[model samples]
Each structure stands twice: as structure tokens, then as C-alpha cells.
Target: MTAAAALIEAARALDALGFMPSKSGNLSVRTGRGYLITPAALPYAETTAADLVEVDLGGAVLAGHRRPSSEWRMHAAIYAARPEAGAVVHTHSPCATALACARQGLPPFHYMIAVGGGGDIRCSGYATFGTEALAEACVAALEGRRAALLANHGAVAIGRTLAGARTLAMEVENLARQYLALRAAGLAPVLLDEAELAAVFEQFDGYGRLG
Candidate 1:
């Protein structure tokens, strides 16, 4: 599919998953010239491919009439910091965003943690949107993982494709939901031990072979 088609497809999928509630999320994919991203303040369910705004790697708009999402600074920072990233997805999924606002990083509570690079996802310190501080914090938190949460904001996921990023975002939220449910049941989460986590990281290349 074309880059534009991919952006719209991702937006719709995230909307269906209830990840993009009421213009609360942003999605973007890398393109040959730069990136095409969702416009700010628009509901994801109503967004068409034509609503996408084109911006260069430096976060300067190259084309399109609409304003880029205010979070484009964070997206641009991720692309700059991690060349492997082909897409970035930010969502305000309930449980995950709640954890973020609580200023807590996810613990290694399940094997699904492996999906985010075999450890707990990190939560960056809070920063104002569209600020350099916010972009820098996001980049720092996402160092070796496919995803991270922004304190008091939402979660961000990056991957080599838009599908992969979207999948990671969904998985992160699912994990958070499970964690919250388990807690509500008065059961302490059985976090994976550091040794086991290290082993998973070491064998991650083999795990990647499954696909």
C-alpha cells in the first residue's frame, strides 16, 4: 500500500481498538521525502488519508494544508534517534495512560513484555508537548525498546512498519489492562526475574525468527 493508505489504515485500526478516542492520539509513517502524519485535533475515526500532513525529518511541514499534530516533535525525535523506526504511534489507551500518569513504568509482569524488547517499558518524565524537553525525554526513555510511555500523557510505540508499531501499542495496553485486573483481584503480579529477562534478551534474535 502507499504511505498515505497505510496512515489511514493504521488510524482506522487504532480507532476500532478504542486507542484513539476523540482526537486523543496521533499516527505517522515515514515516507521517501519525510513523513506523513495525522493532523492535530482531529478525531481518528473521521480522518482520511487526505487529512495527513507531510513534514520533513526536522519537523518542518513540507506539504499539506492541515497543521501537523503537536506531537510531531516527539515523532521526529524518535525517527532521528532510531533509524530502524519506520512508523510511530501515540495513543491514550485507558490503562496504559493511567499507569503513565501514575509515573510508573510497566514491570515485567508477563511474557508479553518480551514483545517490547524483553523488559519493562520505561516512562519518561513529564514535559510539555511540542517542547524540546518532551522530545528528548521520549527519545531517552525509548533507548532500546520498541515502546515507552509519556508521563501524564500517553504511550508511544515505534517499529520498522506501521503495522508493527500499531501492534506494539495494542499489546502494551493489553498488558497494562492485565496488570490492572490482576491488581484489582488482590494478586501481586509475578514479575519476571532479571536473570530470566536477560536470557530472553539474549535469545531475542531467535525469537525474531518465529516470524
Candidate 2:
């Protein structure tokens, strides 16, 4: 499917996952010439391909009738910093964002957490929305991971495809939920050792996985 089609599918999928409530999320996919993104303030369930806004790498709107998402600056910054990032997904999923708001990183308590590209998912310090500070914080937080949580805000996931980004978003939230549950049970989560994390990183490289 085309990148535009993939972007629409991602929005619907996030809506189904209850992650895009009240237009609380944004989705974008890189195109041959630029990127296509969901417009600002549109409910994901009701969004259409026509509702997408096309923008250049520098965040200049080139097509569509509506404004791009307020978080477009963050997305553009990510694209500029990470050329391997073909799609970006930002969402306000409850568990993940809750941990973020607590200024906590996703601890490496589960092997699945390695799916985030190595160790724990990083959390960026809080910043006002649509600001350059927010973009810079996100870029720094995502330096070595496929996903990063914005403190007191939401989460962002980057991938080689829109599907991959969506998958990482879901996984981050799932791991956060597990962490919460385990903590409530008075169990100290067992974190992966440095050797184990190194092995996972090496495997990822050997397999040519781009997440």
C-alpha cells in the first residue's frame, strides 16, 4: 500500500487501540518527496485520507486544506535527526504517559523491552508543546531507542514503517502496564543484565532489524 494509505491505517489502528482519543495523537509517514501526516485536532476514527496534510522535511505545508498537527515540529525534528526513521507515531496512551509524567523511564524488566531497540525506553524532560525545546528533548531522548516518552506529555515511536511505529507504541504501553502491575505486587522486577542487552543489540544488528 501507499504511504498515504498506511498513514490512514495507522490512525485507525491507534483509534481501535484507544490510544488516539479526542484527537490526542498524530501519525506520519515519509514519502518519496516529503511526508504525509494527520491534520490537527481531527478525531482519528473520523479522519480520512483527504484529511492528511503533506509537508516537506522542514515542516512546510505543501498540500491539504487543513493545518498539520501541533506536534509536527517534533516529528520533523525526529526525521531530520534520524534518517532511518521512515514513520513517526505519537500518542497519549495512559500507562506509558503516566510513567512519563512520573518522569520515569521504562525499566528493562522484560525481554520485550529490548524490542525498543536496546535497553529501557528513554523519557524526555517536559517542555511546552510545539516548542523547539520539546523537539530537542524528544530528539535527545530517542537517540538510542525506537521509542521515547515525553515527560508529562505523551510518547513517540519511530520505525521503518508506520506499522512498526504503531507496534512499538503498543509494546511500550504494554510493558509499562506490566511494570506497574509488578510494582504493585511488591515484586522488584528483574532487569536484563548488560551482557544480555548487548546480545540483543548485536542480534538486532545481525538480523538487520531497523526498529
Candidate 3:
């Protein structure tokens, strides 16, 4: 699929999964000139490829009739900070947002936490939505990690492709759900240590690849 089509597809799919309640999330993909992002205030169900907006890193709208996502700055920041991030997925996914609302980061309570490119997923410091402060905070928390939780807001995931980023976003929600379940059951799950996590990372280096 074309980049714009893939972006809309991912957005609608995530929206259907309740990852973006009331159109509270955004998705973007890097482009030669800048990036293409979901338009603001539009439900994913009604969003079409034509609704996607292209904006440069300097935040100028280059194409499309609609305004880029209010959080476009956040996506730009991630693209600037991580050269390998070809796409970004930001969502107010329930379980993950619940933890972020508590100002809690996802600890390495499960080995799958390595999917985020770290031993744990950090929760960014609280900042007002749609502001550069929130963008800066998100970028800082994402350093050395592929995903991060926005304090009292949501979570963001980056990847080399839109599908990869979307899947990582889903995994973030899954991990959060599992962690919360353990906490709710009054079970303090054992977190993997650094060495153990490193091994998992090595194992993941070739995971899902055909030999």
C-alpha cells in the first residue's frame, strides 16, 4: 500500500481496537520532504488518504487541505531525534494511558518489555497537550527507547515502518494490560534484570526472520 493509504489503514484499525477513543490519537510517516500526518479533529473512520497532511520538520504545512494533527510537533520531534524512525504511532490506548495517568512507567515485569528497545518503558513528565513542552518531554523520554508513555496522556511508538510502529503500539497496550493485571491481583511480578533483558534483546535481533 502507499504510505498515505497505509497510514489511514493503521489509524482506522487502531481506532477500531479502541486505541484511539474519540479520535484522540495520531499517526505519521516520514517523507522525503517532511512527513505525512493524520488531520486534526477527524475520526479515523471518516479519514481518507486525502485527509492526510504533509508538514516539514519546521512545522510548515506543505500539502493537504486540513490541518495536521495538533500533536504534529511531537511526531516531528521524534523524527528529528531518531533518524531510523520512519513512522510514529501515538495513541491513548486504555491500559497504557491508565498507567500514564498514574505517572507510572512500565517496568520490566515481562520479557516482552524488550520490544520497546529497553528494559522498561519510561513515562514522560507531564506537559500541556499540543505544546512544545509536551513534544520535548516525549522526545526526552523516548531517548534510547522505541516507545514511551506520555504522563497523564498516552503512549507513543516509533519504528522503521508504519506496520512495525503500529504493532509496537499494540504491544505497548498489551504489556500495560498484563502489568496492570498483576498489580490488580496483588502479585508483584518479578522484573527481569539488565543481563536477562540483554539476552532477550540478543534473541530478538533475529526474531521473526527466516533463516
Off by over 4 Å in 3: 208-211
RMSD (Å) of each candidate, 1 decimal: 1.7, 1.5, 1.7
TM-score winner? 3
Question: What shift in Å separates residue 122 of candidate 3 from its native position after superposition?
Answer: 0.4
Cα lDDT of all candidates, in order? 0.86, 0.87, 0.93
**TM-score of every model versus the real structure:** 0.93, 0.94, 0.97
List, residue by residue over 54-143, the lDDT tens digit for candidate 3. Answer: 999989999999999999999989999999999999999999999999999999998889889888999999999999999999999999
**What does the lDDT come to for candidate 1?**
0.86
The Cα error of candidate 1 at residue 121, in Å, is 0.4
Per-residue lDDT for 209 in model 3?
14
Winner of 2 and 3 under TM-score:
3
In Å, residue 182's CA in model 2 sits off its true spot by 1.0
Task: Tell me the spans in candidate 2 whose CA falls farther than 4 Å from its real position.
Answer: 203-211
* Per-residue accuracy of model 1 over 86-195 as CA lDDT, tens digit each: 99999989999989999888899886787786478999999987788999999999988888989998899988989889889998999989988898899998888989
How far off is residue 48 in model 3, in Å? 1.0
Candidate 3 matches the true fold with a TM-score of: 0.97
